[model samples]
Target: MNANLQRVIVLSLLILLMAATRSHVFSHFTPVPDASWAVFFIGGFYLRNWSRWAFPLLMVLAVAIDYAVITNQGMSFWSHYCVSPGYWFLVPAHLAMWVGGFWLRRNYSGASVASLARLAFSFVAATALCHLLAQGGFYWLSNSVAEPTFAGWAKNYGDWFAPYLQGTAMFVTLAALAQVVGEQISRHAHPFARRMKH
Candidate 1:
């Protein structure tokens, strides 16, 4: 396939995955877990060349999905609990995830132990930064907290960090496995195609 066509296919799949899994209500009714974070990360890795348009597109999609869900629940989008001044901070928070994948792509050499280590480190670092910006913005600026303090923020971050990390890691790992399998198949297929052409 043409490289651009492959990118479009990947981008479409990522968007579909995000849309399908982003809503808590949707996920609650379905077996699929939220793949929003993974979508951004994978998008950064595979669609980095199109980041200028793709990132903003995904961000808009995310906000639009949130709006739909909140309004569908009979709540005004602006009046919803999750929609606050701090909600806009999600831009930076999610950018961190994108950057992580971008970094990984830049450093990725192949499917090797060293590359896998880099992937682990980059992903965890990105997840940590993303969570800090997201949780800090909510704790300090959202007004949802009655008595926000450093200690309270620390505890809140601690409570949610593991689950978010685990979830993102699970999806990323699955993507990694799929990529390896695809590469192996392509490698075998290319040799056969070349022989057939001769």
Candidate 2:
């Protein structure tokens, strides 16, 4: 099989796995564990050649799956997801995550200290952005037409911060686990890395 195709298939499977694990295996109160970040960062670390397309594809698939499941539950997720003004900003927040992973690939070969620092920094920034975007989305959905007063925005944003922080912290822990697992998987996938041992 072509290497890029393999990466895509692997990524697709991992995304599906993450979705299943998120929706079914995990409890509702628990934030979804992000094992897919392993696939994502590995795409950057091992399949750097495929990162451009693969990362976006995986992210979109994850989002679509989540939306589908939420809609199936007959909640107001349609407006909660689509009509919210924060979605305008949320898309870029998500895109930035993939971009950060791709940027990590450009700078790191998975072996250098400074490069590792860059990757770590990217992860931190992306995690923080995800938290803020999620909170913003919730705020917009809850207060769609309210006047954008300082106090109003403040209260909205502040009200969101607690849950947002809790979820983001959980996600950060998952991201760390995924990153470590991804690096290991990348090492195993590389023919050169395998050959070097012999």
What tens-digit string does per-residue lDDT give for candidate 1 at 35-114? Answer: 78888888888888999999999999999999998889898999876778888988999999999999999998678889
Q: Give the per-residue lDDT of model 2 (tens digit) for 1-198.
A: 576677667566667666765453113355454444344444454456766676667667766765776677786655653446665454555555556666776776555568657867876666556546655664655455465665775676676555544543454445546657877887788987678888
Model 1: per-residue Cα lDDT at residue 160? 81
**Top lDDT prediction, candidate number:** 1
C-alpha RMSD values across all candidates: 1.8, 5.3
lDDT minimum window of 10 residues, candidate 1: 25-34
**Model 1 misplaced stretches (Cα beyond 4 Å):** 25-31
Q: Could you say which candidate leads in TM-score?
A: 1
Write down the lDDT of every candidate, Cα atoms only. Answer: 0.87, 0.58
